[model samples]
Target: MDDLVLLRREFDAEEGTFLGGLRPDLVWDKAAFSRLEQAMRRVCAAFAGRDELPRWLVEGFWFCADWVPSWTGHADFPRPEPLEYYEGAVERLRDLQSWFVTGESPYLEHHEWPAI
Candidate 1:
C-alpha cells in the first residue's frame, strides 16, 4: 500500500471560517455545489475502497467543514445552517492534487489508474 499525502495543509480556521461566511444563506448554491460534487465523486471513485485515502480527504468530503452538527445531532457550528458540502469537496480535491501531482496535467494523469 502507498501512503496518500495531502497536497497542501488544511485551511487554517480563519480561512475555513471565511469560506463558510461566503455562503450565508441557508439555501445551497446548487449549481456550483453540483459541479464540485461531480468532480469529487470522480476523484473518490478513482480511489474507491482504497485504504490509502487520507483521513482529511475522506472526512472533509463526507462530513464537510459545516456538517458537524448533523453527525453529532446538535447545533455544533455557530452558523444558521451547514456550510456547503461541495465546497469542502473542492478543497479536498485541490489538496489531493498538490499532494500527488506536478505540472499542468490533470490529476488522473499522475497515476496509472484506469478511467472511472
Candidate 2:
C-alpha cells in the first residue's frame, strides 16, 4: 500500500480518539497524510485532468509529528482534558478541515505542520 494510504489508515478512527489506539499496527500520527490525500483528490476531481497546484503544497503532504501525550488531570484521572501537543493540533486541524470542506481556504499550502 502507498505511504499516504497507510498514514490515513492510521488515523481512520472516531472523530476524537487516539489514532494508534484503534489500529492493528499500533501506528499513529497520520492525520497530515490523510489531509493531503483528500485535498489532492479534491483538486483532481475539480480539474478532471492536470491540476498543477504547486510544488510546496504537494511536498507539504509528508509532514506531521508522532506525538506522545503526557498529561493527567488529577492523581487518579485516567486522562487530561487536552493531551500535550494535542490541543494546539486540534485547533489547527479544525481550521484546516474547515478550509478543505469549503475550498475557499486562506491556507497558502494544502498541507501544514506545526511550526518548530
Candidate 3:
C-alpha cells in the first residue's frame, strides 16, 4: 500500500501559540483547517495513499505563518476572557486531534496507547 503522506504534506497553519485555534484540524483534515485546504485537497486527492511523504507534509508542521497582527495598535496579548476561552477550546481541539493521530494505531501500536 502507498503512504497517504505522498499525497500532501500534513497541514500546518504556521499558527504559533498566537494563532493556535485557527488551524485546529491541520493534522486530520487540512481542508477543514483553512481556506487553502480546498485547493490542496483537490490537487492531492489524486495521489492520496501513494507515498511515504509529500513535499508539503514531509515536516510535521504544515504551516508556519499567516497574518500576524502587531500589538503596536492593539491592546496586547493575554487577551480578554472570552477570546481566551475560545482560543483555549480551539487549542484543546487541536491537541485532541494530535493525540488521536499520533498516539496509536492497530497496525502500529495498541498495547501502549494512553488512556485518552
Clashes of each: 1, 0, 7
Error of 1 at 111 (Å): 24
lDDT for position 102 in model 2: 47
TM-scores, in order shown? 0.37, 0.34, 0.25
lDDT of 1 by residue, 1-116 (tens): 11122211222212233223333433333343444434544555566545466656555544443352243233443433345543354455454454322223244645653221
**TM-score of the candidate numbered 1?**
0.37
As for candidate 3, its clashing pairs are 9-56, 9-57, 10-57, 12-62, 12-63, 14-63, 14-64
For 1-58, candidate 3 gives per-residue lDDT tens digits of 1324322333433443223443342222223334332233333334334544345542
Ranking by TM-score: 1, 2, 3
RMSD of 1: 11.0
Q: What is the C-alpha lDDT of each candidate?
A: 0.40, 0.40, 0.33
Report how far residue 43 has shifted in candidate 3, in Å.
Answer: 3.5
Q: Which residue pairs collide, candidate 1?
A: 7-99
User: What digit string (tens of lDDT, one per residue) describes model 2 on residues 46-91?
Assistant: 5333435444333332222222222211234343233654455544
Worst 10 residues of 1 by lDDT: 1-10
> TM-score: which candidate is best?
1
Worst 10 residues of 3 by lDDT: 64-73
Model 2, runs deviating above 4 Å: 1-4, 11-18, 22-84, 106-113
Comparing candidate 1 with candidate 3, which one achieves the higher TM-score?
1
In candidate 1, position 29 carries an lDDT of: 38
CA displacement after TM-score superposition, residue 75 of candidate 1 (Å): 13
